[model samples]
Target: MLDQLCHILLLVVVSILYHVTFFLPPSWVSVLRISVLLLCAAKPVSVMFTELFGRFRPMPGEGTEGAGKVIGYLERLILVILMVVGEYGVIGWIIAAKTFARSRQLADSQAFCEYFLVGTLLSILSSISLYLVLYRW
Candidate 1:
């Protein structure tokens, strides 16, 4: 719990720093913005995801706790980077790959399917939205 709080605080600091460093070069600004936005979105977006999909709960031994959060963070990081670089095709591949990677878990439970789908979709949507708003390039 404390670790999570620290992680959140760090992200918030980075976000503030990203906004304040407008005098920096555009490339540095973009990278900082991406880092802050992705980190900042990870927890809140996930909380919203759980609230929005409250009907579906994870099954026992179905998924790891922090693992999902870390995976989501990395996923969004990659997605935002890809978006910035305009590799739209690879983004589709990433989604497909994630889906395939979790095929067994997704296939095992209907609730898990809904949970995974909604979470993945929310992650993608949030990444795109953040990129549209924060990214200068």
Candidate 2:
């Protein structure tokens, strides 16, 4: 319970800091906002993801857990860029590519399918939430 509270507090603080960036000079706003967004995604969002779904163990030979973290980072970065550019439709291509890459695991293991779906949805939600917080000011 304490851990969950900390995670929620971290997100709220990050969201507030991200919004604060909007008040900076125009040139600094983009750089600062993206930096903060990426930073938040890197650690806090990962913790949130783990808290929500870490119980689902990966299948044997599924690859290193580090790789998943890297993928999640890249996924969130791409999503934030797409959202910033108003290319929401292209977001589907990212999902398609991930699905294609993991087609085998997705097909063979029900556990992996649920894990993948949950992780992907969480990643998308985090990215969109960060984007909205950063720009909605």
Candidate 3:
């Protein structure tokens, strides 16, 4: 319960940062919002709750097979985040440069940097959450 609340609050903070920083198209923004919200609120909460109810693995036991799989899923998000960062940091600037050829009002570098920052913040938040979730120490 406490964990869920913490995650929700973090998600809210991340959402605000994303909106204030990125200039994503409405369609992409909506999709990104839903994806982040679902993972932050629903996925981890469900994992913890289910573990509480069904079965929990001992710290060093053979019965904890699913633990590795769950952890792998969480860890892979970091790789995805790295890709997102590269895209926002580099590809975004390229696009902005191209768009600038037509419209002089767009601040491609600023937009890219903002998106990169937001992505970094989110990845950090999620990674911290994962550490908390996976490690009891």
Q: Candidate 3: list runs displaced more than 4 Å.
A: 22-75, 78-82, 85-137
Models, CA RMSD each? 3.6, 3.8, 19.4
Q: Output the number of the TM-score-best candidate.
A: 2
List the lowest-lDDT window of 10 residues for candidate 3: 53-62
Candidate 1 lDDT tens digits, 38-117:
66576667666667775676755745666776788788888888987889789999999999998998898887788788
Could you tell me which 10 consecutive residues in candidate 1 have the lowest summed lDDT? 54-63
State every prediction's TM-score relative to the real structure.
0.72, 0.78, 0.30
Candidate 2 structure, TM-score to reference: 0.78
Cα shift from native, residue 20, model 3 (Å): 1.5
Q: What tens-digit string does per-residue lDDT give for candidate 2 at 34-80?
A: 77777776667888787778888575574775788789989988898
lDDT by residue for model 3 (27-58), tens? 77656654564465335643544454334322
TM-score order of candidates, top first? 2, 1, 3
Task: Give the residue spans of candidate 2 off by over 4 A.
Answer: 1-23
What's the number of clashes in each of the models?
Answer: 0, 0, 0
